[model samples]
Target: MNFIDLFAGASGMSEGFINAGFVPVSHIEMDKYACDSIRTRAVYHYLKENDKEDYYNDYLKGNISREELYEHAPKQILDSVLNIEINDKSIKSIFEKIDKRLGDKEIDLIIGGPPCQAYSILGRHQENIENDPRNKLYIQYGRFLKKYQPRAFVFENVPGLLSAQKGQHFKNLKTYFRKMGYEVYHDKLNSADYGVLQARKRIIIVGWRKDNDHGFPAIEKIKRKFTVNDCFQDLPKLKPGEALKVTPYSLNKNEYLEKYELRNGVDFVTQHIARPHNERDLNIYKTAIKKWNRERVRIKYPDLPSHLKTHKNESSFIDRFKVVDGKGVSHTVVAHIAKDGHHYIHPDIKQCRSISVREAARLQSFPDNFFFEGPRTAAFKQIGNAVPPLMASAIANKMREYLCQI
Candidate 1:
């Protein structure tokens, strides 16, 4: 299967798509940091594909940073992303490049969602949400859809798209696609259905050129409740303010931990270090955990102890500083984690700090080998914004079987 990725973040849907045997024809992204992160993954795959993975092997052993890994990158991956800026002037040039790389090859699919901030319900609470420039990004997706005329396409976004502008936004989207003459099917899917340890819900809209029996993939719900311990127990523990660029991990007896272990070299635990926290925040975390342990209750915001109740707008922050119950799946990891990480408090009573970048990625079902490229905070943002590769993979697997038969 061949496809194109638009609004492609560092990980999530595209990672699973690639793992499911789809070849990425092009990746379009606006953020430079996110582009860097995607490029790092491209380089890693290039090295591994060409039997030159020793370069990345060295980096895994603490011999190089992510930047240095590219110095030894294969020409194929670099050229794949060479010139395709997303601008009015560059759209034509990008189309021409696609023609060159994908010459005479019908694009089997086009995949991606418009930026979701403008359509997110929580984000709409802001005054500027109505006319946010990003609200119009869906038109850009339309342009590509019309140009490629792929046999199939998958569009994904937050459920807010269903209710934006009193449902007008969603109505307009359906109208636009209907005019294109494709049969569209949309549904809200939970990540937990695919074994991701986070309760993230997103709307997936799949379209087919001609109607028959095919529709969106059927994803089965996971019976096991993937908990905090299942996702984070094996990684090295860290103290507040402690940071390490590289550290060894035990070849633990867990599925994920075992997949990431390095037998000959020191496979570093990347972006797993803790950030510094103020005394007030630290004390609040300690108190929250203690309250949960003694009362078997979650310490949500607005119910904070007197010393911790500082915000005047307490009602809006009711779920703020929330400590995830250790017995079940984590709450949805949002991009807000990059700002301060207060929402995703560690469930452990002793580790009075926020979950690290690696932990957040785990909740999103990102594989341990998938290294994120950026500052620590940027890494967290990318993880929070991803679609959970495991979930995406299940969808891709079903789509693959159906499309190949066609």
Candidate 2:
């Protein structure tokens, strides 16, 4: 099956679909750094298929530049990543480019959702958010469905999308998709239910042609037997301001890492680096970690000593400083982590810092071999915004099964 990914942030959704044996027609994304990431991922897939993974490993080890890696990959593979924004002015050209890529093939699926910020609960608090331009990106998504008329589509977004504008936006979305000749079914799904270590809930809408008999795919829940510690146990520990781009594993393989392919037989790890923290924040982290370790209680920002308190808006967002629970699934990883790590502090007090890039990726179910392009902040933004590949692969497998029958 062939599919086109829209708003393909870091190609997480694309990775899952590819892992399920679906071929990507093209990936459309606006951010330059994200586009580069998608291209790099495409190179990885292409090299792996041709038994040239050594080239990719070299890139990870900093032995070769990204340009050199791209030089080895075919032009079509690199060109499959479209670094253009989707809007009225660009949709036509976008369609032309995708059509060229498609050639004689048809798109079996259309996957991806618009930026979720406009519909997110936090975003709704902003003034005039209803008029936010991002809210209208769905119209562009509808346009693609209308043009391609694929057999099915998967729309993924934050759960806040269900209640956006008092459910009016969702109603309009269903109506719009219906007009495009799709029968839509939706449910709120937790990533943990699909094998991701983080308990992130998202709104997943599956739509098929109105003429088809298929309904939403029944994705079964997975019982988790491991905690976030399983994801963290093998990586080398780091203090604040420390970094290790490519380092050998600190420990042997464990059940969670082996079962989920997070380790993926990679001999080395990259981006296991931590952000620098001030003495004040480190002290606060110590308090938070001590509280959680001893009493299993999260230390709220308001509970901090007067010297530790920084933000004045104490009435809300009081639990701003948080520790990643090593005993269980983590809280939702958000793009805000790029701006600061207060909400994603590491559980180990010895580190006295926020989680590293590789650690964050592990929480999101990204494999060890998957190298994120661009700087640390950009990588975090991509990871936080991505659809966890483990969950996406499950969803994609279900979609493929349903498509095959019809």
Candidate 3:
């Protein structure tokens, strides 16, 4: 089966569908860094397919530059990632690019959701959010469906989308997609139910052509027996303001890592680096860690000592300085993590810092070999915005089964 990814965003959904044996016709994304990341991932997949993963490993080892890695992969694979925004002015050009990559192969599915920030709960708190341009990006998504007429589509977004604009937006979206000749069904899915250590929840909207009798794909729920600590145990520890591009694993792979294939038999891991924190923030992190370790209670921002309190309004976002629960599934990782790490403090007090890029990616169920292409902040934004590949793979597998039957 083949698919086209829209608003691809680091190719997280693309990663899962590809892993489930679906071929990507094209990936449409606007962010340069994320497009680069997707291109790098494409290189990895191509190299792996041809038994040239040593080139990929060398890139991770910093022995090969990105340009050199791209040199080893086919130009067509790299060119398939279109770094263009989807809008009225650009949609026609975007369609031309996808049509070129697609050739005569029909798109089996169209996968992606518009940026969810506009429909997120926190975004709704903003003034005049109804006017936010992102709220209408779904119209762009519908355009793809109309143009390609794919057999099915998977639209993923935050649960708040169901209630955005007093449910009118969602109603309008369904009406638009239905008018495009798709039978749409949506449900709320949790990542933890799909083998992810993070308890992230998303609204999954699946649509198929009206002629197809098959309904929504039955994505099976997986019962995970491990905790977030299982995801962290094999990683090398880091302190404030430390980064290791290539480092040996500190411990042997445990069952969880091995079971999920998080550690892909790589001798070294990249981007296991921590952000530098000032003493004041470090103190707050220490306090938060101690509280969670001792009493399993998260420390609110207002609970901090007067000397450490920086923000004046303590009424809202009180639990701003939260710690990742090492013993259980983590809270939803959000793109706001790029702005600051206060909400994603590492559980181990020894680190006394926010979770590193690799750690955040691990929480999002990205494998160790999936190298993110950008600085730490940009990588965090991509990871936070992505759908966990584990959950996506499950959906992809079910979708594939449904598509095959038809």
Clashes of each: 0, 0, 0
As for candidate 2, its clashing pairs are none
Q: What is the descending lDDT order?
A: 3, 2, 1
RMSD per model, one decimal: 2.6, 0.8, 0.9
Q: How do the residues 1-406 of candidate 1 rate in per-residue lDDT, one tens digit apiece?
A: 8999888887478888988899888888777777877887888777877888788767755687776888787555755653244656777877887788887888988888767877776788889687887777777777777888887888889999999889998888877876776778899999877777778899999887775338776767667644667678767777777775566664454653444231223355666767789998898888777876678676677677778777778667576677765677888888888888678887887778888877788888887667777788888888878888888887888778878878
* Structural similarity to truth (TM-score) of each candidate: 0.92, 0.99, 0.98
**C-alpha lDDT values of all predictions:** 0.77, 0.92, 0.92
Better of 1 and 3 by TM-score: 3
* lDDT of each residue in 330-372, candidate 2, tens digit only: 9999899998899999999988899999999999999998888
Least well predicted 10-residue stretch by lDDT in candidate 3: 211-220
TM-score of 2: 0.99
Error of 2 at 363 (Å): 0.7
State which candidate, 1 or 2, has the greater TM-score: 2
- Candidates 1 and 3: which is better by lDDT? 3
